[model samples]
Target: MGLFEKLFPRRPPDADPRAYFKTLTAYQPVYTTYRGGLYEMALTRAAIAAFARHCSKLHLEIVGDFRPELAPVLGQQPNPWMDASKFIARLATIYQVQNNAFIVPVEDAAGRLVGYYPVLPQQTSIREYGGAPYLQYEFWGGQRAAVELSRAGLLTQHQYEDDFFGADNRPMLPTLQVMRTQDEGIVNGIKNATTIRFLARLAANLKQKDIDAERKRFAKDNLEGNNTGVMMFDSKYADVKQIESTALVVNPKQQELIRESVFEYFGTNEKILTNTYTEDEWNAYYEGSIEPFAIQLSLVLTAMTFTPAEIAQGAGIIATANRLQYASNNTKLNIVTQLFDRGFLTHNMGLEIFNMPPVEDGDKYYIRKEYAEVSKLNTETDPTGTTEPKEGDNGDHTGDP
Candidate 1:
């Protein structure tokens, strides 16, 4: 009914899931637990989200003229179902959380690579079939598919021991447990501070029923909204003391340790997660987290999308971003204004630095007229326009030329 719906309609329920993973072998019903379940935690989710958001902003450009037919699909929109932002965001999130993510080619009716998509299955494994390596995917609904391992791209981290997959988050469990303990301590502390308001010693002469009635009466009279901050009590109690309530103060050092654990593991810092990072911190975070991901994604996609011959001909994929996006406005201004006048940046490149679209013939390079080759400068004449006075003439340059 809406314009957006008309443009990007939802997939039909009856459509086959093969739109994602193109299988070359029989499906498997295997169901294995994935270790990425830790992404559901708060800090883990925050780290992944921050990483994915920045990664999604990167531009996936297909370099060279090798795969002209598939360039449009792979560059802006990996698949018809999702745009570049959604596709890259989902891929980055999966790669960061799972430590291993896969991208398989989506073929057309003629078996041509039309688009590529990340297939996130509940279980995935590499199997050998007919002397060839095959990658298998098992979905949560018990659906499964298999593809040639060479045709699929894999991005992995913590991949020291396993030949095909990355290691699990076993070492990080202790740090996570410390975080859990701190949270529980805070919760229990708050319960203690807020639950019991007063401690009273009742007179021993009162009967059990009288004591119960006195307790209820005291609560009804003093705890009700009608009563002011002043808590009033009768002579039924021998002694009474108001409990002091204070906030649960977690140890700053312990909290810092927990934060450092997360930051180190994710290769990020508090400023990056909070979006208050300086230019230096942003560059560090980009190189540590985002640049590596872009590099890996570029290499994997290039290898998966092209043959050895094509790659040898300089046909490949590259993921690049305007690292200046995180720089301060003044820095960006300097980059655009300074670089533009020197012909260091083309018209489109200058516009792109500010995230603007190119105009007609925007690829042309322009430079200021004052800039010229050093060889072209006249060495004989004084550049100041006053001719040097001859030895015989008085030191006035206007006398002779």
Candidate 2:
């Protein structure tokens, strides 16, 4: 037996590729003090929520003369199970949490591509054999299956030593820890402030049993909100005070600091979370965060879905966000008008920019009559030394005279 076979026993050809022996199973990740698993990390850290929301809202589109039949499947809806937006949202969450997203293509019996199904990063494993990596998928707690990379689609924003997987956001451990601590402190402080405490004083001559009875009576009567007033003898004294908490005041500063850090880590700003960004800031944010992801997703989708010949024939995929989403109506109108007036954009193209159907002769480019070449302008001026009207000016003089 070869070394590859020795390391991983080969499965029977007829056996289901999704089934694997227990011995071949890989180790699962455990929650750590600094970070938890995918779901836990998202739940505990506010940064993940911001990242997911920001990425999910950004639109995704495929741009290219690609397969017409595959458009509905890949562009409009990734699968019958979910629409394109939902699929992208799920993919974005997976990418942010694990830094890698894997999709399995579902094909019909005729071998035509139908839909794509996303697999959780934690539920999948990568194994190397004969110097190449193979993906292993696990489900229902123990069932394992191996899939070839060609059959599976993968998207990764950051590359790592392991070719099969991407680098995770584990480096943010310290920041996450600080944020977690701040959150816990704020929660504890709020709890303390909401709690009620009592101070009681008893007469020195009072018996121990009488003191105990008084304490019990105070607890039974004063603890509940129903007892607003309490009757006490001269020997017994009690006062109820609400715990003064600094959390309401102190936590805001810490919370703001944490929010800034979280937004910075995700390459977004507070305006995005607050929905208060100006037009210019929103454009910059889209360029920095949303555009890159869309481009990467387009490249991966094209490569996985199209053949070399098809790609060579101008067949590819591209993800584009709606311009209206980032820019206001006035901004879009100005841009389109400027480009069109300068002859940089044709009428049809301008119409397309507004998502309107092109009309006849819309492909023609027009320039303003006042914009003439410098040489043409020079020719139009009089070359004579004196600026005097010559004979036949305006063709009113008669040559016969």
Best candidate according to TM-score: 1
Which lDDT values do the candidates have, in the order given?
0.76, 0.62
Worst 10 contiguous positions by lDDT, candidate 1? 3-12
Question: What value of lDDT does candidate 1 attain over all alpha carbons?
Answer: 0.76
- The sequence of per-residue lDDT tens digits that candidate 2 reaches over residues 197-270 is 55566546578898788777777766654355754445345444334544443456766786666667677876
Per-candidate TM-scores read 0.80, 0.70
Model 1, span 1-401: residue lDDT tens: 53223321332233223332323434432224466446867887899899999998988888888778776786678887888888899999888877888787776656677777876777876665555556666677775566777888888888765566776677778887787788889999999899888788886687889878987778787787544778776676788898899869789998998899888999988888899989989998889889999999999989988899999999999999889877878898999898888888888887777778998998877888665446533322357765454456565445544
* Clashing residue pairs for model 1: none
> Once superposed on the true structure, which residue ranges of model 1 sit more than 4 Å away at CA?
1-37, 205-213, 225-235, 337-342, 367-401
Worst 10 residues of 2 by lDDT: 27-36
Q: Best candidate, lDDT-wise?
A: 1
Model 1 residue 168 CA deviation in Å: 1.4
